[model samples]
Target: MPDAENTLLLVDDRPDNLFVLRMVLAEYLPDCRLITANSAEEGLTLAGRQRFDGALIDMQMSRMDGIEMCRRLKQEAGTAIIPVILMTAHHAPADLRARGLEAGADDFIERPIDNVELVARIRTMLRIKHAEDRLRAGNSELERQVAKQTAMFREYWKAVENSRDPFAIIDRGHRYSLVNDAWLKLYAIERTEVLGRPVAEVHGDEYFDAQIRLSLDSCLTGESVQYEQSFSRNGERPQQLQARLMPIAGEGGGIDGVVITLRDVTREREIERMKDEFISIAAHELNTPLAVIQGYAELLRDEPWTAPYKRTQRQEFLSLILEKCARLQKIVDDLLDLSRVDSGWMLVLHKSRWRVRDELDRQVWQFQRETLKHRFEVACDLSCGEVSADRGKIGQVIENLLGNAVKYSPRGGLIRVQAEVEGNVLRVTVADQGIGMTPEQAGRAFEKFYRADTLDTAIGGLGLGLAISRSIIEAHGGWIWLESEVGKGTRAHFTLPLMPAGTEVAIPNEMSDLKIAGEEKP
Candidate 1:
């Protein structure tokens, strides 16, 4: 019995001959379907109509001989691949056998045929036919898979080409195989200048050897590597870049190339540094006042009750403790306000109609008494009228500006406060003869936790003052900005919209007003 089902064609002129052939095939190859025809003409007709895995035909036919039928089957494209066998008499001439061989007959069977020999020849032909069939099917499937993978590669390449991050593919020889548009733009090179060029030639040999070669080698060894590299382009500021290299596997299951992607992390790295500096400064700022309050409280607690001048000493210790507590409270409040601004919930302003000149005069007079190192002067125009704004918030902004002026101007320089009415706005300026900032520093002066002073500077304050002041002024529909030059001076300017002369507006309740310590209410 055969392992697989197959159809076999048997042809002979005599009915008894056809019967004997069918019985022999049915008994030996039980799994195969046997079809019999009485003549060579009938066999050819049946072969044209249906498929057969193997064919057996008697040589001595009256009209069409077995050799002629085999020749006809081989001549047609459809049946050319089917295996054919010819059965001959035991005493047949050698020319008859030679004729069958020339006609594409696969094997010859002699009669009286031995049943074992007939079965063996038929099995061999079937095995060859099945092998050819499998080979054709395998070729078709391989072609289909190749087409599918080609399409996928095209899609992936398109995505890489259009991506914002720089991407490139480097072959095992360290020559560029492919580079996307962003990669070309980043290096300021054309496509013709990069493709097929050695990586060392593009990025100088020194840079390649020092920074990129080690990572590329590691990636080619099937390891993914990532590192930071800083380089300037077109004489601009140095850009911090994060580069990642990953191995690309070849068809033979080994690393064939490396895929490199670079991301610009200059701004991200700057923010990280600023955050770390802010944390250290905030810790120190909070600790100093806390230590002062703790020491004064402990001194007052352990002091003898019967000591001379105990009453006056106790009052002085209490005053110092209160001052430190106030300082700590201001720090906490400023931190909370900055947090609120960052979280998108800005400060709540209690708007009221207040004279801009009066607020400026009051803040200027207060600063004059507090600081002896700097002289204070005010010039307010009579035309400066009332403005609809938050009084306490406005005062806090003024105090922050004045305090910065006094801190930065350490050599008893003049600090002038000026205000005037321009159109519908009241413009105020606080200028000081101070150790000022560079243009770059002034640009970022309003950013949260950003300070013009370096860590080594003796000046102390949380950098949140200017940032919070901007938020307060902007919330009131006003604008704030700073102008400064290194070692010369700084001028802080802010503008508030002036209320119309006869216009009346509702003022928030006194309980809802923002209260500041030592700030008088109007």
Candidate 2:
């Protein structure tokens, strides 16, 4: 590590001067390797080819003087740091010494060289060179290590940028140190747009500062956090994102940076909305009948009337109790239907086909008797059409749709039920002049237990009606939907394949006097 262990370039046009200097160096600094050059040009060549700790130059060389050679070496980067010692035979004038100093010589020694003076000056120069050499070696090693670490960092950053999930890293200063391809793709921006920018510059200042402050505080304390956020880009509706921020640590548990991952959760949140609606509807339906039963029971115990009229009062109470009990039983049935659909228990057990026209007629007759408040119109022109579906499920679908129509419609409004055949598909429609919903509400009508109207209507039924109807129709390899406009009317329409390919069709019904008016056979 000492300068003496390094190569020393000795330049002198006179062989005697080179020999004298080499001998002095050999005696005092035996470890130093000497590279001899008879001229300044040769010394420059040697300096470029080999590493030199120091250079010894003769100030009075013939072709090129030591001052000019030192200047040239300093101009060239390869030998610029090497220390130069200028030797002159003529006790150089102060102005010449000044010129030598200006030319970048580190030390000057006058020659015909007094041995003690020559040795003393060279020893001093060698000491300085030794220190510089050691420093340079240490610095070179440090720079090499830094270069290796930088390469590794670049490779890791590239891998993260190529990942599918949106990923980024932020320093304590809240500036983006890294951002990935997926992050840019999701935000519809280039990765360059975000890197090295403050968080506020990329995301809006308000949003970015709030979220970053929270994440930074948590991460600084060695904690991880996750939350949801909404962001709007351009003029589009805001998008939902689920974000997780984790702390990256360095040696001694110091906070280094934060790694953040973001995922789109809009669709998942919508599904949760549907689930919550289902729960609300189910709870309301259960509470309704229970409330009715409780009211009647309390009236029977608390209200007082003449003992002579006790018989009639008891009869009336019993009738009210039976009605509420029936409503409760119907709610329980809906729950069971939902369970069956979810558990796949209903589909595996059995399957059957029934006369389509007969089933339609039967549902209409039953609904007519049960809900006399609504006008029921049935038009089944296809008297012999048979549908290949599970008899129970098909009946449930028809019953649910019809029941919803009757329950939600105004008293004595038109409730049109029609069945017809078009090519290989059988179409059934239930149209009602009732409280219709907006397009947005209609889109979510079949979602489990959703109601656009207020809960105060006291409809006395679970919101599972349309959900169950659609499930059954879909299970039968059919498609069901509704067409509606607010305040005008709503119509539930479904289509079933004629005979399910190779299956035989059963007779529809035997009913005649079929005055099926105001309905067209498709």
Report per-prediction Cα RMSD to one decimal: 10.1, 11.4
TM-score of each: 0.65, 0.58
lDDT of each: 0.85, 0.77
How many residue pairs clash (N, CA or C atoms closer than 3 angstroms) in each of the candidate models, in the order given?
Answer: 0, 0
Q: What is the lDDT of residue 205 in candidate 2?
A: 79
- Candidate 1 Cα outliers beyond 4 Å, as residue runs: 1-164, 233-236, 498-522
* Model 2, residue pairs in steric clash: none
lDDT of 2 by residue, 256-329 (tens): 88999988887688778767766777787778778888998888777765643377887898798899899888
In model 1, which residue pairs have backbone atoms overlapping below 3 Å? none
Residue 194, model 1: Cα distance from true site in angstroms: 1.4
Q: Give the deviation of candidate 1 from the true structure as CA RMSD.
A: 10.1
